[model samples]
Target chain A: MSVVARLDEARAARRQKALIAFNATTLRLGGKTIIENLDLEVRPGEFLCIVGASGCGKTTALRLAAGLYGPTSGAVTFDGEPITGPRREVAIVFQDYGKALLPWRTAAGNISLALEASRVPARERSSRIEALLRKVGLPGHADKYPTEMSGGMQQRLQIARCLAQEPTTLLMDEPFGALDAMTRQGLQDEVLSLTQTSQTTVIFVTHDLDEAIYLGDRIVGLLPHPGRIGIELAVDLPRPRDQLATREHPEFLRLRRQLFDFIKATEH
Target chain B: MNRAAILWRVASILVAAGFIAAWQLIANLRLVSPVFLPGPDRAWAALVRGFSSGDLASKLIGTLEHMAYGWLAASIAGIALGALIGSSRMMRAYVAPSLEFLRPLPVSAIIPVAIAMLGLTQGMALFVIAFGAIWPIMLATIHGFAAVEPRLYEVARSLQMSRAAVIGRIALPSALPDILAGMRLSLTVALILSVVCEILAGLDGLGQWVLLSARAFRSADLFAGVILLGATGYLTSIAVSLVEQRLLAWQTAAR
Candidate 1:
């Protein structure tokens, strides 16, 4: 009945209606256990960031969620259904932008790849591709090859191509890891606004603590050597986050510090 | 063009000129018997005569037609099989040994077998050309497809693209640079094999013309035919390289 209780109730409902969840997932790759007894729940429209030191299997976990890889045991589910393979509505943006986009395809052509995958009618593809490019702040760059663009621009182009799928969930694997700091921040804000406006659920994997706090509605830190969730922190930062004010906010600083300490402790 | 490119071009022309001048000097001074190797001028005169009499034109057309058809057939067959083998681990395992076994046997060796089957006809020449040309293309395409970054395949799978679509869009384009390079290599092989086939079978081609002129002791005509073969090989390679440039301009620009 109280404001706090009402908010708690809303949170419970969101948890119940999770968009993607990993249930006691175990994954073995090349005879080595990569992930063990991992459980995660991602609510619809929630911006969740997974963070850890290198080899923590955060990206592997994201891959499990995207159905790019199946678990060695247990299940990854979407909307209460088991995920056996990549779904058209679930799109991934890889960290290696150089390898992700087709070198032969122009920026527009790259976006058109997703459109074509989803089987959007040819007549509607041009306008949709244009709109996605505009959304990602890459207007008029349709003709530019991925190799010709700057790292930041290429990342944006990648994001635009993913958006062309009009995916319900965006799974990014350290998508901005290669960008310069300024460009990283710029893309962070752009991604925040775009995901916010689209109301798409996001499961972003990054090693950066500040990035986890800045963009995530919740943060999940995985401990390495058979990766499993060690900490789960809810970020209550205000929406429409500002680059200057949001990072400087007390709660954001607290979360960032906590995540950093957790990571530092886990590194050993 | 950059200074280096222009300088290289000039350097190449100078090298050719120097070689020709030396050959002329050797023949004019009778340093080597003219019967063994005719002078450049004598060869040129024979080339003019052959063209004017239209013997060279008809032979050149026959060679060109055979090379073109054989090259095209090999390209298509090689690419299709290479893609199949490249895409499947099972297919690669099953097919690779036979491919390796067949690849190393010289095309010249196959000429006798082809003659036994096809009886020294044009079919025999076509068979040799196609068979010889296919290996480079197939192997290169297989290597290219296998070398595609694993992440790209992940991207394709994540996009939920159909198997056919994945091969058509991702596999083929990613392999294109290597494919074109292979095609270039195969073009040379095709030229060599076609000429070899012509010589061995006495078929109607530049190779046959050279053989007949040599037997008849017409050194100038023999030298001219050999020169034309070298020139044709050089020109065809240049044409393929131009096409490769046009198709893979993005690759060059990206680099």
Candidate 2:
């Protein structure tokens, strides 16, 4: 390697240190530790997935990253600054879309909530909301209420609302768990493309191993009972991943097997 | 709209007609003295006479004003205090016990106390009606606001919503169904208390009109005043139901 190439590589490595970090984070609730002495770093614009068993505190970790909860004994930081509370540039998509959505608000109204919170002017709101709705494949359904939409459509509406914030990082807590097989696959690809184009860092938490392998740049497997990282793998699957070709890839299969084994072991 | 619904409506009309016929028969047979139990014809005649003479209209207006003012005051106070107490864990802990202690005490028991404090005046009647009506609305508001889904709060936090915005945009909308239910119950309470207070305070309302007619041995007039009061209660409740239906249209749509 040439001297100039080495210098460029070192600079890139330093820049990739962390956008969000949980430094020795420990969270206790109701006299029981939920997450214990954890350390995790997420690179900027990386799609990181955390996959584990049911009681592995994966959602709790996502909540911590979203700054919805404070760690009991350690620090969670974003952009090298300690996160004290929720920020405008960080949007979270919850698993229970029904509860997360305002039932009274229409689809357009729901997406406008993030814009309203950001204090975007009223005139600019409608146009921006139209673009978001179109982007999420919910065009011309703006006036429809969340109750009127299918489960898959409602989840898509939720993503649109989150995207309205134009977030730097997106935190998703098992968002596809309630969806059907076909709907989940469609959403998986939609989210992948959305985040890829926006270059938004994502920390997606789920129990499905194949989903983690398909969408993540890096995958973290968590252990239950005082939740901590059990295994970590870097997915080298080619980008612009195809649902068929990517899952069929040898690397993807190997990572899926490794995660499945880790999850099964945690059950014991 | 449907077979069952049409059948129910027809059944209700038949029941009302049967009641009136039975009442008229008892009067015609002289089972009760005319002075004690007037016929439906006499009652209906008295209603026409009172309304045409404009006496009953003014009395109705007075009673409605009292009920409306009292109900409005109760609604405002109940929702404000409920939002405050329900949104805070500390407030719920501190005030909930006192509220529980006071809630079950029959509102009628407070009539004499209200009369003693405010005297025999419209103010006393207003106070009594408001005091009686406030409980259901306030309790409902508290329950509604407190029972808001926890996930919605998380969404608010993620959106970086302020405390006021959370209460206004999220908590208020979520709690509206409960609040509206409470208000409907409160409206009935307001109407009942309005009559009671007007009777006790000798205020210019249907209650006072009925009491005066009884003293004068005008049984038909007394019955007419009562029918008018019943109609008022029915109409007001229907009005509240209409408002609730409009506000909670989404709930029904979801179903």
Candidate 3:
């Protein structure tokens, strides 16, 4: 075998070890099928994006991985064990930043909540909170309440709080959809770099075509009506994705076009 | 302060002065009999006399003491019961109907029953005030708890908070603004009930003082007692608002 082919094979083997797996999962809510016979694997330290039109259960899949919902059949496993409930090793960043944060807590107080939940010692919390806030581009916002921040800042605060959990995997449900285009793009890049640096596995759900392409190392598209995976594309673009060059890359454009057509067809 | 705020404060003081002037004029002109409506001078004399005689002070103290004890008891009980009812669907369902049934019953009407059971004592007056005041506190608490954002609950659960921690940290703080609002309303209700209890039971309080002065044809003393009650209510509400401000400064800063 060629040397390049051998390297590809080794990389694929490492991915197969898997950080999270949804095995033959089906979910029924109120006598209606929401998702059916779904099987997917998320590798450790990989960015996986799930994209679909509305009602395609993209968020449902993320929730399953987050252990917020239990499948009616089959099981979701994390690191080789079936997930019975939300674990400290897994944290979620929700889309509705306004509703997700405690209005009564300042930015630092909110991050402190996660630390307190994890039983981190009080003496160590201030420095950790300071570091997490700084990491999220909110260095001096400790005394500011969630209501005092802009939508993007609140979203950043949410991300910072999730990071305080120090989770191995981060599950995000359309977290950037609520922001404006510029803010969304900025956060998308921020999240990308942060996750890469932390080596954190991520399962991000979004309906935006470009967002899925821009962020995911691998993208999975789902079809509605008993939502199931319809298309899977590996993003072979090089590391450190540049906003301008990555979008201009022929591979990125090709994936974008394919996913756009797939969504257009499935949306009907 | 800003110019507008300063102007409004001046305007308020002027309006109050104008009202007193009108009251003095009306009394001087004998627009209404002094027996029915005492003038400002008569009322002021009554105030000085009552304070000097110590009749008003002891009565005021008595009324305040009863309200303080009853309100404290009701607040503790209301918050505890409301939290329980708010958190559990089963408890809320079972308890809600009975609360709804009793809620509309006039508190004044219950004073007679309290009088019969506890027999015209301070305890009876306290029982009446506590019963009357608890409903608002509990209902406001229930509303606050129910109004808590579902996403916040999910966040707490995701953080793996214990049920106790969720209640103490998340649920309680989220429900506070509403609870504090309830406490304010309940404080007024407690004051009202205290006077009503005093009047009905002939207890040694501001209400009884007013009742006796009226019976003895001393309208000035009656007017003085009424002014004192109004002042007490206003001061209590202001105190509550100050505390609410301190606790919920985060909410204000957000706005």
Which is superior by TM-score, 1 or 3? Answer: 3
Q: Is candidate 2 or candidate 3 better by TM-score?
A: 3
Scoring only the A-chain of each prediction against the true A-chain gives TM-scores of 0.94, 0.94, 0.95
Candidate 1 at A110: error in angstroms?
A: 0.9
Assess the local accuracy of residue B159 in candidate 2 as a C-alpha lDDT between 0 and 100: 91
Candidate 3 has a TM-score of 0.96
lDDT by residue for model 1 (B95-177), tens: 89999899998888888999999998988888889999999999999888877778888888988889899888999999999
CAPRI-wise, candidate 1 is medium
Would you list the rank order by lDDT, best first?
A: 3, 2, 1
Give all candidates' CA lDDT scores: 0.89, 0.91, 0.92
- What is the alpha-carbon lDDT of model 3 when measured against the actual structure? 0.92
Q: In candidate 3, what are the lDDT values of residues A1-268, reduced to their tens digit?
A: 4435744754575567889998999999999899999998888998999999899999999888888899999989999999888999899999999999988999999999999999999999999999999999999999999988999999999999999999999999999998899999899999999999989999999988888898988889999989999988777778798899999998889889989999999965
Which model is ahead, 2 or 3, in terms of DockQ? 3
Instruction: For residue B12, give model 2's deviation from the true position in Å.
Output: 1.7
Model 3, runs deviating above 4 Å: A1-15
Model 1 per-residue lDDT at A118 = 87
Clashing pairs in 3: none
Candidate 1 on A1-268: residue-level lDDT in tens?
Answer: 4436745754676667788988899999999999999988888898999998899899899889888889999999999999999988898999999989899989988999988988899999999998988999989888888999999999999888888887899999999999999999999999999999989999999988899899988888999998998987878888889989998998888777878889889977
